[model samples]
Target: MKKFKKLFAATVISLAMLVAAGCGDQPTNEDQGDADNGGGDEVVTETPGDVGDAEITLEFWNGFTGPDGEDIAKIIAEFNNLHEGEIAIRTQTMPWDNFYDQYRTVVTAGEAPDIAIMHLDSIAGYARYDLLTPLDDLAADIGLEDDDFIPEVWDAGVYEGHRYGIPLDVHPLTLFYNVDLLEAAGYSEPPTTYDELVEMSLAVQEATDGDAWGIAMPVFWPSNMIFYSSLMSHGGDSVSEDGLTPLYNTEIGYEALQKMVDLVYEHEVSPSDVQADGEVTLFRQGNSAFHINGIWMIAGFEQQDGLNFAAAPVPTFGDQEAVWAGSHNFVLPKQNDEDPERLEASMKFIQFVSENSLQWAKAGQVPATYSVLESDEFKALEHQYNASQQNFVFPPSTPFYGDAWGPTGPAVDEAMLGQLTPQEALERAAREGEENARDAAEN
Candidate 1:
């Protein structure tokens, strides 16, 4: 595995260097003189070839730096073996923060990879910059339709009127419960509603005699995600349709955030000062009965010795059921010069991964492809299947959506820390978010 990764990394570096050199020397359309006059150097461009006629190597970039990386590597290996001399995919893995920071720089320099794995929320941002190629025609060529994917994830790939990504997998927030703790509290199953959640949590606290709590509510990390789900459940929208206005500061928003705050303060079911990942630690250590986190944590939780845990969809905490989810998407970066054969190969690779995403599910994600999700093999995975069935709420699709929602985390943190009331925190967040959105739009 290490050898394969090293080889792929070297190939990526070599390809990138060659591309940079080509970009630096290539003449622009205006710089080219009359072709027949022989006044300028002859420009030779590679014409589109049949996919199987010549071996094509594609550069792929992604930020799957955890256990998930290993799973994807396996899938890539399978694809490479199947294509053998026809096509090869070389990958370069980096941290997500670095991926986001460096992609635009590389794309602007005309040295972007042939393929990239993007997050659903990030598709619009890159599309807005014209850094991504529209995938609608390519998708149709490969027989990939919207009906083949989860509706929310499929729609997330579209920016303006064009599709820039192909749905891969969805990872949603779920309820993780320690089986022993729940049983000790006289509960045989996880809670399905807000009242039961609170009731069970309090009972667990009483049973544990304060040594273990009912829940541990963190003030950071997933707190923001939980808030989003709650906001949706309360029938609140994160932003206006135009994506320029913050809409999560109304009465519904207050009810959403206040409910989370109450878990720590009023109900006393959770600790007041749990920091980021504190809830996870508490659940793993059997110090808490319930922990709300993303399904991505399943692999790590399964590795803990002597820990008995199970997962379920997050219980409804408001007027409706909703869960925060995000997806990984396959995207094609806009190239300085496009090659049809390479593009065709890249699409084929994407289709293979999407179809075989059950392997991805083993890495603790819900396959976004409808056929994969409905397969008996996938349905057998209780946790992932259950989480996939939730009414998922995705981030708004807009180039400036990130900026529009930037203040939400700190706002939720303030409320959780009791430094400000839910109403006060959301008001401040909405005011700042709107300003940020306006500034980003202008830029």
Candidate 2:
């Protein structure tokens, strides 16, 4: 152990000296063009650091404050212990609601952490504002090739032509069913079709004598994601090919949304006006036999005593199969005073996390890497592996996605509450999307 520590120390010192020597050529902010992208032709040379030589400490910020946060913290602790004097990570956990605001404020003030975990959909926005470093070269050095990851997840890191993020895991919305309830309803398996889902839901209600409903409808924020996924399952898309206009106003979209409304109002198998958390809570309390939520809820549900739940891909509501999904990515915040050593350390940590992502999968996220997903260890994870292989529909690449996403829940809620017809609700949602697009284009 002493010999290993000495060698690791030597490696750290050698790399530090090399970086110090190269710093003389790094450009000052005044002369730096597009400073946010690590301006100037600063060359970086990577030297593999020996284990147990963690001398450099990198700050990391993430919004994983739930049960997953403990898993992430444990992983980081392992990384620190393994690298000892070569690399150390200092992490700050925060609630996701305030994370972006804090990140933006710090980034604008040049106080950004060396690394941050961000949602894949939000990458384009930060990249557009030059707030993140393009990882093409660094990624190559870390051996993060496209072959290692799912094509869709790997491609999600790209903005325009440059890659800005490295995906960590995928969390897709899937169907969660109460196993006992399904059996009581005479369903040997979960529903595979919309009609089957409705029928089973109705049966569940009848079997329980109104003690529990079929499903709890989500009517808040990302409830739109479910609606959009349903629309796409029917061969409908919410955005135009150019991503500058909304296409959910079409007849196909209306039919898709109408199906959701009928589940609540017509079939009466689902409760309307329930918020996102309320849906999960209802399912947890055994008030609903089926729930549509992200894979992240798996760990929590597994802990619910007597819940007897299982997960499956969201049923095919239309001619195609699609489900709302998103990925978490590790990104380096663009820094004007870029240091090669710190950058290299950051990438090394990310690579370490990616390589040992089975620990992450245990937290209920689908590993972003194909090999990890196919591993015996991951395959044992049950529903996540199957759900990850399904057709996942992500938000279109756009800097203004948040703006457009905001209007969908209200519109979906309106339709579910009978305040407007499915057609009118879709039209309102489309108008909001178009207005957001116009604003984004103008700005």
Candidate 3:
């Protein structure tokens, strides 16, 4: 039942301290291109209230433009109906591409919304800019103690020892296999070990006569996550414990990247130069037998016309088990005019959302609350349950964690595309990360 201690002021420290202190990675929230709703939309209630007609209208904003966005809208509707006229929330939903730009512009213009959704990784940058408010008081008021949320997720929202956000859900990378395809390949279950995964991939390739791939590998966002996951599984890390040195280019890193390269070239189970969308399409079209993607794909995949699929945890590929994960969090924007009532209402909304997070789970996320995760309802979600309870790994808690990917991402992309060797890619990424760390340390 630990509480977040308030910071006297926003702290700005070197990236080394940020990393050493355990700040998480920068999540790449992709645009699913579901709708182009760019402006604020108000959600109205249907039922009567328990808080009477002492009404409070709050503005909420989020970048949930995927299938998850629909779920969020539905949750907002339900919350409104339950609260009735007492609390009305006006919501603005948009794609992730411009979400931060619009949020920062509004906050800078002194028209900040009462509350907004944010990625845990981006909290440090926002807090550094003094664009977010510390939520320690509101968290306490709503009884959101440390034990209420997953430790990794809870700590991710803290920057320089001040809590700035409340996590809603964690999206982790998971394995999705086409049931029919697996059976066709003479396998009753998805691969549980790295060797087993490779064997299955090879079998699928042979069975399909090279017409179908054993797996799909994206060269962009998914690539970075998979590489990091692999690195972690090998008992290696991206940066040193002190956060001053890049470690991914070491022998262990080479091993991890080599494994990825082997999947494409050495084993010939994956397609080369496949973009993210192409990889997803291959899986959806039944051309790929297995896919490693975020849990967010569950809702969409379940709706595909004739695809029969099952989910599993990302297998233990190396000495350790690990999978890359990120979270969506609720944050309060910095405001020129502070209204205690509005803040209180916002906290209540967050608490209500946490309590009813099963609805959010319906959008293919791992609930942040242990209570929800341990529920029979959540356990019924096969993929999410396993991923949440298994070796889910978050990026190192650091402001520089996100920026480190700038170089590492490209290096991995090159290796996947066969433009560089695995060792070359790891070495390059390490050099780039070291330069980034050096710059941050000096400044």
Candidate 4:
């Protein structure tokens, strides 16, 4: 242990020297990114540090404040202790609802953590502000290849052909249905067809004879009403081909939403009382027939028993299939002064996390790095959902995504409350979403 401490101290010194050397050259926008992409240039080399020679601390923050947070904290503690004390990683948990505001304030004040897990959408501002380090150079040094990741999930790091974030995992919305409920109701398989799905729901309600609904999710959030989860299979997108107009005004989009309403108000198969935590709790307790949520809900699902459920890709309302997806990724937020040692260390940490991500995948996130996903252990995970998680889809992930969805969510909520007719609600939501997208584009 004493020797380990000595080596740790050496590594820290080496890292500091590397940082000092790194201060010399920071690449321009045109020079940095993955070569797998045609747009990036090589990053200059810096001095190497001995792992046991130095002492440096890094602050880390994330929004897993729920049960998932507890597990992540445990993983970090192990990482910190495993090192020779050369790398000291500290963690902070922020509530998901307000994390962005907190993150923005700190970063603007030049007091941001050495590393952080950020949403894929908000990084556009960070990139635009020139606040992050390019990971391509570091990736090349460590044999980190772009081909090692799911192209769709991996490309998330690239903005304007330059990569900013190192993706950790993707959490996509999936269909979580109660096993016993389906079995007892005389349904052996999940419905692949919409009409079959509705029929199965009615059967469950009739066979079980209770408040259990066919399906449930908050119907409000005008933009959410048109969320990507239910429409991906149909190749339906809420944005026009140019991404400058709202496409939800089309017959396809309205038809999709009308089906949702039918399941609720029309068929009376899905109860209205299930909202927010209520829906999750009911499903967790085996009180509901079906739930539409992301892989993150796996922990909560595990807490319940006699409650076998399976995850399937979202069904197609038209002729195709799709689902909503989000990624947890690492980015080097702008530093008051860029240091090479810190940058290299940050990259190393990211690589280490990616290599050891199986611990994370068990909690329900899809591995963003390909190595883990194709690893023997990952394949052996006892998860029934893995079979269907391969094809998660989200809307065009761009900086404008937040504005498009956030501002229009309230309009959707109002519509769910019956404050507007479908046409009126869709028109209003479309207008607001478009306006928000436009505002972001102009910036």
Candidate 5:
């Protein structure tokens, strides 16, 4: 079949890349002899290195499908060209939709990529299934320090005291407002707190005469981070410190969810027509005045038109501020007990990528490195403009973490649509959430 041929060609190209990749480490003197080993028509690293006698070949994979992919590919190419004979990396791009299936098949079948990219939420899922290799010992061997990254981002990879991955980026919720829309609504400033947000929503709604919803964000059973901001903003904790049981049924959680629901039902600012109108759609269409999202949306928004907007860290609902965040981490897949030479190459690639993360941020995600995070280049990224703004906290990492997301999101949504009272929604959500968590933990 055509599909089979395409896969075979890709694999062959990958093998050729592997052969040339190792030559990059063999020193320029040895490259001549190394070239005789296979087809020489392969892509090489961008920079040349004196890796004459050492070689590490690591197979890397990711679902970059966005602008980030282009930038990452360039980085990988440069690493190959520079470190010839020392390290050879074979990189593959997978579509985001079928990424998990492809990932699991390779990992379980003993053909796993040397290293791959994963989201904070997903690491827990894969680690639970034993498809990932722990980076603890390797991390120690290479002096890979987690302290260099934000505590929340780094900690996302630490489940059960054994790190399964290394955090690469932090994507927290931020408020992007259309300046033109704000000006038309008679407001010059963006909301800074819960009260301010409500007022702004009311003003924007009144000014537009229901033509536009004041705000837009996903509120459903599958959404995790959206409610996290609201709950954390209002001093609510869905799970206990120990990740034992659901705790959002308490006053703070109840109050927080109640207020969000009221924003629609009580204030009449949110739409109530569709069964599933996710916020992402509304924001892209300019259907709302305020949008709650991460800076990673910057690249996409830059391509759109008729919008004047800026990003700010998501606001607080309490004395202390926080926003729901997650990370993309670089992880090594278990090689089915094959002590391949690529482990060193994997480390080289990872360290190089981490060190060069400032370039990575331009694609719309925060680099995990503290130095890059503090650097002027990254700080000045139009999307990451609120880097120094306080309390950009991510949610806690728990084995049942994914279950905690939508459990609270829709409770807030339904109550807002007046389909159910706030108290009723919270009560049902708490009961259902605890059951879900318990089921996951038990399984």
Candidate 6:
């Protein structure tokens, strides 16, 4: 797996200096209206004409360079048409890595877009760098209430008592099974428990006479996400509440990781040398009975001719039901000179997207808004809706949280490859994660 590196210290320092030199004190929760009230307590509804009489164009940026990009472009076109002469949104899309790298450069140079998209785990890091604007007031102005959104995703947008993101959608890891393979193995339904998974997997392997494997366990890509779901299901956390300590090197962690390695070595239901996306290819070609992947693959799977598959909520691999999930959220970048008109327009645009996210859900994502999730249209998306039912687990909100978790992938890789015992790998990861967190805090 590629390690996601942290932004350079020098770049962060320079960006901080630039923000300090040019921007004034950001608004506090109290300044936004009600300090004690939750989101949407003081609603100030506005129309397109509220942003003065003159037409304005807001620059929106994101990293949706996949099949979902087409979905978002259509939505943006509709949004642009609805407002017509009153407001327009100009979008800039790029790869996520390049988006992260260039975002800091643009912010430092006072060329940041009016609005952008950020992942739930990244909100705190960008907020810490003073590159994002708090959206409490804007959220309330658009009548965005906590009760109207998925609780996990809604709460994840806040950092240090201020809201920095408006969640767009959630994509969770789910179980994908070949229907034909299951039936061939005398199984009518997918497994719902660990014992069932093992029994069915072995049954399929034996029935196939080595023609097709039961599962394909990739050594990288989503291997870490699988480990995370297993850890959380065992009632273990990835980090401490303070977000400055590692917490996954315990007996629970060992058990969680060993389960994955055992799929290759002990049970022998999966190949030992599966690489990144190898499992995906195997599942598509009907060479594997089962595969675990994110819901985002639903669209691509549908396009694969003659692949008979269905999705289910991730089966219980531990003591509890938990699955790894992440959300994309709309955020406002800090501008050198705050424009009330653009801010209002951006909030309105966000509200529009949130309300109409059923269109976005067609791209195989679960809309974070409650109404959309409850809609008949969204419920019609059986695979995505099923995957959304799992107890979603998200990373702790902290600056450099991804960096702190970087060592875990290589550790998981080594364990899966049989280079080290699960205990040794997790211990090494925990120690290195602690050092990474400490360095982040000190810097």
Select the stronger candidate by lDDT from 5 and 6.
Answer: 6
Query: Where does candidate 6 stray beyond 4 Å?
Result: 1-54
What C-alpha lDDT does candidate 4 achieve relative to the native structure? Answer: 0.58
Considering summed lDDT, which 10 consecutive residues are worst modelled in model 5? Answer: 6-15
Q: For candidate 5, write residues 147-224 as lDDT tens digits.
A: 787765676677677898887776655688877778878988788887787788878878877777888634542133
Per residue, candidate 3 scores C-alpha lDDT tens digits across 91-143 of: 87655656766777788789998989977656776787688999887899879
Query: How high a TM-score does candidate 4 get?
Result: 0.81
TM-score of 6: 0.88
Summarize candidate 2's per-residue lDDT along 1-443 as a digit string, tens digits: 00100000000000000121111111111111012112222222222223354578788887666667668877888888788776878887665545666677678678988999877666777787788999999999978889888667677688888999999987777789998999998888999889998999999999999999999887653456678778878887666544557666888988988988889988999887786478878899988989886787788888888798888888888977777677789999988789999999999999999999999998888898877888899988887776776676655456555444445667877887789998988788778767865666566
lDDT ranking, high to low: 6, 1, 3, 2, 5, 4
TM-score of each: 0.87, 0.86, 0.87, 0.81, 0.80, 0.88
In order, the Cα lDDT scores of the candidates are: 0.74, 0.72, 0.73, 0.58, 0.61, 0.75
Candidate 5 or 3, higher TM-score: 3
Candidate 4 per-residue lDDT over residues 77-144, each given as its tens digit: 55666654577666666554445555666776788777887666445545655666677777788777
Give per-residue CA lDDT, model 1, range 1-443, as digits (tens). 00100000000000010122121111111111101111222211222222243388788887666767678888887887778778877777765545655677788889988999877766776787788999989999999978777776787778889999898887777899989989998999899888999999999988988888988987876677788878877777777766678888999999999999999999999999887668878888989998887888788888889889888889888977787777778999999999998899999999999889999998889888879988999989887877776777665567656565657878889899999999999899889878876866665
Off by over 4 Å in 1: 1-54
What is candidate 1's TM-score against the reference? 0.87
Question: In lDDT terms, how accurate is model 1?
Answer: 0.74
User: Any residue pairs clashing in model 6, and if so which?
Assistant: none
Model 5's number of clashes is 19
Q: How far is candidate 4 from the true structure (C-alpha RMSD, Å)?
A: 12.2
Per TM-score, what order, best first?
6, 1, 3, 2, 4, 5
**Which segments of candidate 5 are over 4 A away from where they belong?**
1-56, 206-211, 217-224, 241-244, 274-278, 285-287, 387-390, 404-406, 409-413
lDDT of model 5, residue 240: 58
The better candidate by TM-score, 1 or 2, is 1
- TM-score-wise, the better of 3 and 4 is 3
